[model samples]
Target chain A: MRRRSVVVVGAGPAGLAAADTALAAGADVTLVDSAERPGGQYHRMLPDAYGARAPEAVQHGYRSFERRVRRVLDHPRCSWWAGAEVWALERRDPGGAAPAAPAPSCPPPKVHVLAPAPGGGPRRRHVLEPDALVLATGAHDRVLPFPGWDLPGVCTAGAAQALAKGERVVVGDRVVVAGTGPFLLPVAVSLLEAGSTVVEVVEAGARARVARGWLGRPWELGAQAGKAGELLALTGVLARHRVPYRFGRAVVAARGDGRVEEVVTAAVRADWSVVPGTERAAAVDVVCVGHGFTPRLELPVAAGCALRPGPRGTSEVYVDVDDDQATSSPGVYACGEITGVAGAPAARTEGALAGWLAAGGAPRAGAVRALRRRRDQGRAFARRLAHAHPVGAAWPGWLRPDTVVCRCEETDYATVCAAAQDPTATEARAAKLATRAGLGPCQGRVCGPTIAELRHRHGTGQPPAGPTDPGSHHRPLAQPIRLGELARPPAPPAPDRPDLAHLPPEESGS
Target chain B: MSPRLVPARDDSVRRTDHPLTVTVDGEPVPGIAGQTLAGVLLAAGRTAWRTAGSGAPRGVFCGIGVCFDCLVTVNGERDVRACTRRAHDGDAVTTQSRRSGDPGDARAGERP
Candidate 1:
């Protein structure tokens, strides 16, 4: 029997699990990721050459991740392709050449990758045709815009953590970590461990509101105990380090000359509007701010998958998957944040299911039932977390008209507000056309959420967020690829090509 | 700033056995061999990469490269995202001009 071929788009926990499980299930597997190494964002491994950082900074089941990564890399049926940026997914039109060595009779979907170069120049694109693809492309920092958010020294909490983990450098002399959710705690601790002067941690949610969400369901309280202990422990560390933890507050604005010098924060009402007299200033060289996370929908949307409401009822779109972790599109399965912003555990469980199913492993009713139960538990916990730290709708009250909403396009509050208020610009796409808010190089990664909220919070704003809708990103090429390479004439098709074993090693970062 | 936060001498996390110098805007900047170009920039005190038309400086917003706010010039290549590219010894880098990737400069931040 011919073996099935599979490509997992991310190498993080979910992607790695998917690839590993598929390989174990007898399907040949290839793991492709933009990063130079496997371990998507959760287990993001630094380049091998960088040896100065501390592994303890990312102390989330490191031994397990190491073992999992090893399992994928060491498996005879599994291959790892790092530094591969998937640009687009092309459906296998009938009779067209498929990208991998699989059942040759039926062409599978082809994935286009723009391989990264060490010094950055013209690079070759590698094409992969797999019988199944699991997209575990993880989430990025969700930043709610403030007056000086576009300033030089203001960065996301994820960036601060990445620097310490990947480069052994903390981003600030005196950093003020601001945002909602438990994610901020580790970020602050990572900075402190890395020797940064963490002046404070400011949470947007009030203590009472956060605790309500933390308590969640009664049975889940046992599940929440570990996280609660972690959060409590982080607070103790902050006290020892003399870092103040402030609740019911948010960084309304960051001010600086060339780089950030100060963060002005204020207490907020339940709706998140600022309290009148609570404004205060903190002197800091860097401000690490984030609302939470938004699911990365580019890959799934590009693949023409069905979209569902994101975790916590946010307008963010995510790929909809079924019981076996299969996406609406056949042969495509989505795990991890791509399905929704559940943490590593949920993503891993989903990944195992996806890998097994994508490998054509027949579902045994008993095992399937057990796995489904576990998957549900993980998701329920995530929902609680998302609800606890909802991106306050009133957050925009902090923004003045001149504030920049889209950093890539330099679109400001005034311009976006104008577009939102305009009758012709009722939709996000129309507003984008009118003001270029979400049309920058990022294709709206930094500003899309804020733009969507602005179009609504302003009341006059229109164009409800929808899947494959104008308000949301629907671009076929999710990641950017050089025009010169893509525009170059397609190589003549090789006939009867199902052999990929002889491909050269990927172009590694030197 | 506290001896410029070099990668620790030894840690469980990966690092290079030796350090290398990458050039930033014609000036030699010392960095560990395996650090990212953005890491090199942050380690060297060159935090922000470009000044906007509004004169607001922008650096590593979404450090994982999705934001495109960290674009810079590598060697002669214009408008490359520093967050995504790794730094090699003697790699030439420069702060991208605010106007570089706008409609004006033909050499702008192009995705690869």
Candidate 2:
């Protein structure tokens, strides 16, 4: 019997684990990512081409993370296509089957990749048809737009950390790292090490809330107990650097003439609503803000997977998965953050399950049982974290009519509100069309969540900001390759695969 | 102008390469390899790239390719994302005006 072929999108912990486990189980695996490097956002390191001399000592966090990724990249049965952008997903259905599928029913979907350069050369697109598809596409920062967020000196905390790690650079001199979650700690430490005068780390979530939730849940943390060690170390680093750490406070607004010069830090209640009496101005050149993460579900949603309402209170979109990590779509599996934003350990376990299933393996029952228990614990902890730092919808209070919400099209709060309140506009997509909020170069990456929430508030009277479908509605060219790349002459169909009817047309020769 | 903030360059890690000059909004800016065009601009303390309808300037919001707030015209190619596009020596970078139309019909001119 021929070995099953698996295409894993993303090189983060989940995707890496999926590829490696599936390959180890005797399946051919191809790992794909947008960055030049393999590790997803969490374990991201500088590419080898950068030629870092002392690799381990340079980056913060565990080097073991990279070692885990190395296991995947080193596997003989796995091949990695770096710097590739997945623009579309084409499913070939069996004849007279689902109306969407153009061709006869083919079990797996064809992954379309735009390679800026395949072999240190010209850009080209390649098609990969797999026996099974594993989407480990990770998460990106959930931007809650505040006044002056679009200013030059302001960026997301994740972006700040990535810049320091990838380019060894910090944004500005006096930096204020503010947001919810402990993710800010390492980013602050790294910036401090990079000679930035960290004014303070502002956390919106009250410290009492975290202790109340996590103090008793010690057993669930398990192997991640080292998180406490890292936390203690980060606290020491901040204190030694003379950086003040403030809790129950958030950077409500950033101000500057041309770039960020100061941020208005205000104390907040448990739900993160700002307290009126505590507003104070702090002079800082760079304001790094992050609320939390939202999963990158474009590929999964594009593959026609079903989304169930995420954890009880959170407004997150979760790809419904069973014990085996299989999605509603046949032969399609999702793992890691795409399943839900659990930490790396949970992601790895989910990936293992997905890989095992995709590789056509009947895993040992005991091992499967153990993986499910770990996933449950990780998910539970994630829910508690989400509950603590939930995105307070009251942020619209910070916006004036002119404050820009959609940076791509320059749509402001007033415009989006007008569209949302328009009696004709019932759904979020209508607001999107009227205001052109999500229709720019970004296709709504900046304004999608905020717009959807505002629409939900005005149109439906729904509250929380957690569970909105931030994914772009089924557009074929989601990534937006240049038209010049697509206008090439149609290539001849391969003799072995002459029926290329299911795929979109592209020029065979330039 | 005030003196620029000094970065922590003394760490164990070495930069990918040396700095070279790239023109940002017609001014010569020093940029290094492995840094994006936006990184170079942000390093120089210039953030607002283009003035939009509201008259407030837009800079890097998402910092990744998605946001496109860090967009600038590089060598006459409009709608280029400065966050993902690396800076090269003598690369001419200019502010992207939101109202300006793209110079092409770029899809024309066939053979690569």
Candidate 3:
């Protein structure tokens, strides 16, 4: 029997696990990631040139991750494509016009990749049609707009942490890390470790609400003891650094001349409505803010995967998957934060299950049962997380009319509000067209959800559902491709070979 | 205040002393291997490399390439993300501006 071929679109924990287990199940695997390394944002490995003696000191579960990296990348059946971006996924027509024998009823989408050429030449594009596809593209920080967020020195907490972890570079000499989740703690620790003087870590969730959200259910957290311990250790580091961790407070505005010189912090109620007379100012070179995470949904949506509403009471949406980790679209599977913002452990378990199933592993395998239970626990934890650090419905109150909502288009709150409130612009699509908020370079990856929510809040009525919905989050071109690259024909698919040796010189490298 | 690199002795993450220079706007800026273009610029105390349509100075916002605010022209290639691209020796980096009348407008030549 021929070996099943699997293409995992992300080299993160979930994608790595998918490749590892698929290879173990005797399937040929091709693992691809945009970064130069195997680890996604979670395991963001420092460049080998750093030659760090204690890389593990800055990472969690580093030893296990290292083992997985070797096991998958070194496996003969696994082809690793680093610094490759999946520009598009071309869905095969479901209609049986051109009959291709042995193709699954729901054929996997054709993968279009832009792989970097060896030795810094122009990137070459390749196309692949695998038997099964696994998506683990992961998520990015979702920052709410504020008065001076577009200032030079303000950045997302994830960006600050990425600089510290991946490059040993701190974002600033003096910084304020403000957000609404446990993720804020680690960002502060990373900043401090990278030699930044973290003046304060401000969390928007009220102390009582946050505690109730976490302590409301004790038994459910038994599987997450490791997570709790990690948070506790992070808090200890903050205490040792003498960094003040303030609850019920948020950085509502940033002020500076050319760059951020000060941040205005204000106390907020449980719903994040600012309390009158509670505003305070602190001088800082940089301010890092993160509300939560927004999943990289372009690939999954491009693959035509169905999305279900995210955790209770949130407008977020995640890929809908079955018990076997199969997406609604056949031959497609989704894991990691794209399914939900469950942490790495859950993503890994989901990946293993998806990989095994995609490789045609037995449905009733003993390992499959264990993986499902862990995935369920992860989902439960995701629910608790959302309950605890919910983005306050009143967060829009933080926005001033002049605040820039869309960084790329430089669309401000007043313009967005005007578009939303205009009687003629009843549809979210109309508002987007009017303001050009999500049409900029980012393609709404940063402001889609926020704009959708703002429209639903300020508009005359709820925007009609479907792709036209501002939050639909659909884009035909998943990644940016230059006109020249797009005009060129994709490399022809190799015949019956899953090995990278068949690929062009640029992508043939392991 | 400028961002600085964490010293090897302080963090136990020893970086190779492989020195490299990338010219920025005709001036040579020094950096080490494994550091991104954004990292070098931040460490060199030069933030706000790009400007918005309103002429507001911008720098790294979302450093992982999701946000295009950190874009710079590299080696004459337009709109390369500074946060994700590793700086190479002799790489020519030019700061970009989106102000309507500025020649640096990324879309200026493409349209009317």
- Which ten contiguous residues of candidate 3 chain A have the minimum total lDDT? A95-104
TM-score winner between 2 and 3, please give it: 3
Q: Best candidate, TM-score-wise?
A: 3
Q: Pick the candidate with the highest DockQ.
A: 3
User: What DockQ do you compute for every candidate structure?
Assistant: 0.54, 0.41, 0.80
Tens digit of per-residue lDDT, candidate 2, span A224-322? 555545667888999998899888888878898887878998988776677898899988888998887767777777777767766665556778887
True contacts kept of 1: 0.69
Model 3 residue A324 distance off true place after TM-score fit, in angstroms:
1.1
Interface RMSD of 1: 3.1
Which residue ranges in model 3 land beyond 4 Å of their true spot? A95-104, A461-472, A492-510
Chain B TM (all candidates): 0.77, 0.76, 0.92
Off by over 4 Å in 2: A47-49, A60-62, A94-106, A119-122, A365-368, A460-475, A489-509, B1-9, B14-16, B25-27, B53-55, B100-112
Candidate 2 local Cα displacement, residue A436, angstroms: 1.7
Clashes of 2: 14
Report, for all candidates in order, the number of backbone clashes: 9, 14, 0
**First chain TM-score in every candidate?**
0.89, 0.90, 0.94
> How does model 3 score on DockQ?
0.80
lDDT scores of the candidates, listed in order: 0.76, 0.72, 0.85
